[model samples]
Target chain A: MFSELNSILNTSPENCPQGEFTLVSDRKADASFLIHHFLSFYLRAGCKVCFLGLVQSFSHYSAVSQRLGVSLTQAREKGQLVFLEGLKGALGVLLEEEPSPGTHMLGFLRSPRSDLRELFEFVRASSTVLLSLGVRVGAVVDFAHYCRAFVCSKLQGNMVMLIRGEDEEEEECDEEGAEWLLRALTHQCSLALRVQGLPTGYCRDIHGQMEVFWRGHGSSVTGPQTQQKLFQYKVHDKGVSFFARGTSSAVL
Target chain B: MLLDIMQTNEVGGLVIIQDTVDCCGRQLLKGFIHCALKRDEVVHVLGFEVCENEFRGGLDSKFTQGLYFHDGYTDPLGWTECPPLTVHHFTPQDINTCLSQSEQLKTVTLVVDSLSWILRHHSPAIVCQRLQELRRGGALRSVLLLLHSDMHQQGIVGSLCHLATAVILVAPGMSGQHTVAKTTRRTKSGRVTREEECFSVSEDLTITIEAQSSCSGKTLPEPEEYEADPAANLTFNLRLSEVEREAKEKLSLPFVFSQEKKSALLHPRPGAGRILYEPDDNDDFDQEDPDDDLDV
Candidate 1:
C-alpha cells in the first residue's frame, strides 16, 4: 500500500534506520493514515511496537490494522505490541474508586499541575522492558518529548509522532502549547511529513496533499539530499495512493 | 547585506532571526556561525532543539574547531544521571558558567539555536530580563537568537523583537531557489536601517547573498514622490488648464445673487407679497366650515 511512499522515502520497514525521529503533521486534513501506515510498517518489521493510542481507541486502530493485513490482537498476545489507550485510562483515573495498576501511567491526569514526569517515567519503564526483550522498539505517541530522549538515544529505536497543525484563526490558550510543541519537535525530528488539504476546497479526485521534508543530517541511505517533496494522495478503504501533485487523475 | 552585518566586528547586542515553519532559519543561523568562526570569535552554541551531531552536521570540519556546544537537547530535564547541561533550571547564570568554561573569552558569540524553546519553558518577562542581563553584562560579543514566529503569540514575539537590536524576518521567496530576509537594524547612533535581500545557503554551509531588492537608505522613495498629486490616476480631470481656468473665471454661476438682488429679495416691496396655492387632483380642500351644520 505504501510502495510509492517507500520509494520516495528510499527506505522500507526492513531497512529503515533506527534512532530516527519522524514527525507527522496535518493542516486542514487528516493525517491519521500516515500514522496507521507507520504503525503497521514497523510492526511488520518485527520490532517491538508501543502504540500510545491517544486520539483513538485500540479497537479503531485494530480495525484499521486488520484491513492492512496485520493482527494487532495477535501481536499483543505475542508480546510484540504494547497498546496504551489514553482515553480509557483517563476515564479510569477520573471515575474509578481504585484505578488499576495498568492505568497508573495516566496518574498525571489527577495531578494539579498536570506534570508529565509521571507519564514520562511510565514510558521509560515500558521501553526498558521492551529493550530487555532484545528487540528494536518503535513508539507511536503524541507526546514525543517525554520519550524522545530515551527511545532514540538509549534504546536506539525509532519514534513516529502525529500532531495536528494549528489553525491560524483559533488562538485558544491550550493551542499555544501545542503550537510550540510542534515547532520544537520539528526542529528535533529527522524527518517531517505534513498533510494539507486543498486550499481551493474539496475535490472529488484528489483528497489532499502531503509534503515530506528530509531534515535529518544522518548518514543514512536516504540522506538530506532531497530536502523536500510534495505529492497529492487519495485514501482508500484498504490503501492509499500517492502521486506527483499535478499527476492526479483529475488534473490529467 | 546580512553577510556584511555578520562580518562586522560589532554586531548588535541582540540579533533575532524570526522564521516561520515554511522557511526555516537554521541555514541562516549556520551562516552566522560560519561568520563568527571566520572572525576568530569564540562561538558557544546552546542547542536545546537538536543534538550536537545534527547541529554540527553540514558544517565544515574546520568550523567546528572553535565551536563549543552546550547540550540542552539530551536529558533536558535531567531524567538521566548526568547531563552536560540541564534545562530544568536554565538561566543566564548557567549560560555564563558555560561561557567561562573556555579560555580566551574576550570576544564570544552566544548562539541560542532557538529562544522559542526557552520562552516555552520560562516566562517571557523573565526570558527578556535574562537576555538583557546577558547583553548588559558585556560577557559576550553578541547573541544570535532563532525564533519561530508562528509558534508564539504576537505579543510575545513583539516583546522579544523589542529586546533585540536587529530582527531578520525570513520568508520563502517567490522562487524556491532562495529565501528572502527582511532585516531591520537599529544602530547605536539611533539610525535604523532596513533591507530586503535574497539569500541561498549551499550544502557546505556557505551563504550567497543574491540581488538586494530594496533598502531604506538607498531605495527609499523621495519626499517629492510622496508629494506627487494623488489625482493623477483619476478618470476625470481635477485641475483645469490655463485656457479652461480663464473660461471658468469668466463664467458666472446662476445661483450666485448680486448685492442689489440680495437686498431687494430681503426687503421686498410690502404690496408685492402674495401667496400662490395650487391643489392637485388628489388634494381635497374643505373650504366650507363643518360648524355650519351646528347651531353656532
Candidate 2:
C-alpha cells in the first residue's frame, strides 16, 4: 500500500531507515484505515512490527488486522509483532498500577513519569530491545489526541505517527500550539503525509486522497529537490490502494 | 444562553470558554461560576493562571464556601492551605490525580481557569493525552469548564476545542458596545449548533449577556440591508479592492490640475538636463606635445 511512499522517500523494505519518523495527518480520514494500511505494508515485507496503539485498543486493532488478513497473532507468536496498548498502559501508569496481563510496554515502561527525559529513555530502550532481537522494528503509534515529544525526537526505529484531523472549518482555528507541534514534527520527520476523506457520490465505500511531502536534505551534499506527490486512494475489502490524483485508475 | 446550555447539558459534558486576558473578558468566567454555584453544584476552581485571591475577590463572601480553589501555582506539592478541601498543584504530572478526585464528586463542576498555563510547563501532547484519559474515564461528570487565555499555547486550543462538548468564545466587540460570546454546542447525537450573545460589562465587573439577534441565521431587515451593502452602511469598511479605492495621490490633489509629479517615476527622463562639454583638467597637453611648448 505504501510502496510508492517508500520509493518516494528512497527507502526499501530490506534496508529501512532507522530512528526516522513519519507523520500521517488528515482532517477527516479514518485513522484506523491509514494506520492499518501502514502496518500491513511493513508487516507484509517481513519486517518486525510493534504497534503502540494510544487511541484504539488491542482487540480493535486485532479485528482490523484480521479483516486485512495481516495475521498479527501468528506474527506475535514468531516474535515479529508486538502490540502495546498505550491507552491502558497510560491509564495504568497514571493510577500507578501494573498494566494488566498481555499488556506490552514501550517507551519508559520502568519509570511512570511524563518527564521528557524519562520518555526519551523509554524510546531509546524499547528500540534497542527490538533491534537486539535481530529485527528491523517499525512502530505505528495512533496518536488520536496526544503524543509525547520523544516520539518525534528520539525513537531509534522506523515510526509512523497518526494524528486525528481537526474540522476543516476550524482550519484557521486558535490551536497555534497544535500548529507549532505540526511544524516541529514536519521538520523532524522525513515524510509528512496528509490523508483526507473525499465524499463519494453514490458509492458507499470510503474514498480519500493522500498527499506525501518529501523534503530533500537541505545540506550541500545532497542537492535540493523537494518533491510533493498527490494520489487519490480508497479503502476496500482487501486493503488500501492508491490511484491517479483525479482518476479512479489504480497506480500499479 | 450559557446558563441554559449548562442546565440542559448532560452531567459528563465538557465546556470550554476561550477568552482574552483582558479584565472585562475574564469577568465573564465569573458569571459562569456564579451560574454553576446557583444550581447548588460544588465548583472546583483549578486556578493555574490566576491565584485564589484573584478569583475570590470577584465573588461574595457567602458563595466562597461552596467554591474550592486548587491554586496550581502557589502550592508546589499538591498541598492545601485550608483543611477538609484537598487542593492539588495543577501540574501535568498530577492530571490523573485531579481527574480521579473529580470522579469522586457526584455533583461537582471542575473548572480550569486557564489550560494554557499548563502548556507553558508541558508539551501539548502530554496535556492532550491527559485530557483524552479524563474524557474517557467519565471524570467530567458535572461539567469540565476549561478556560484558555489567548496569551499562550494558542494552537493546542484547537485540539481542546475538538474535545470540548461546548465552546464559548469571548471577544471584545465594537468599542465598549458589547463583549461577544459565541457558543457552539455539539449535542449527544453529534449535531452542532452555534449561538452568539452580546454581553455588556458593567463598572462593577458584572456581565449581562444578551442575545445577538443580528448574528442569528434568521434574517432581520437592518442586518439584511447591512449585508447587502456593508461598505455603504459602514459595517465593514476596513478593506476595499484596488479598483474601488481612490488613488493615494488623487486624494491629496486639488481641482487646479497640478502637474503629475515626474520625480516619483523610477525611469529617468532623457534630455531633461544640459550635457556638460568640459575638458579634462587633469590632462597636461604642454608636457605631452613638444609643439605646445612654443605656446606655453
Give the number of the best model, judged by TM-score. Answer: 1
Per-residue lDDT tens digits for candidate 1, residues A1-252, read 266677887878779677777888888889988888888887887878887776788999899999999999999999888887777887888786587777887776676554566656766754421211101112122235547667776677787778776555355434334455566567667788888898888888889999998774453322222368888999988888899878987778
For candidate 2, the docking band is incorrect
Evaluate all candidate structures by whole-model CA lDDT and list the values in order.
0.74, 0.55
Candidate 2: misplaced stretches above 4 Å? A1-12, A45-48, A67-69, A90-119, A128-156, A169-177, A199-206, A217-225, A249-252, B1-296
Q: Using lDDT, give the best candidate's number.
A: 1
Worst window of 10 by summed lDDT in candidate 2 chain A = A131-140
**Residue A60's C-alpha lDDT in candidate 2?**
83
Model 1 residue runs over 4 Å out of place are A27-29, A125-143, A165-188, A197-205, A216-228, A246-252, B78-83, B216-296
Q: Write down the TM-score for model 1.
A: 0.79
Per-residue alpha-carbon lDDT of model 1 for B1-296, expressed as tens digits?
68877777574478999987666787788878987887667889988766677678776777677899998876665665787776555677788889987776458889987787777677889998888888887788889999978777888999998877789999878765678889988778766778998888777767788778845455445588779776779998887899999999887787888897789888869798777889789656666873544557
Clashing pairs in 2: A108-A122, A175-B155, A176-B154, A176-B155, A177-B155, A177-B156, A178-B155, A178-B156, B11-B141
DockQ of each: 0.16, 0.01
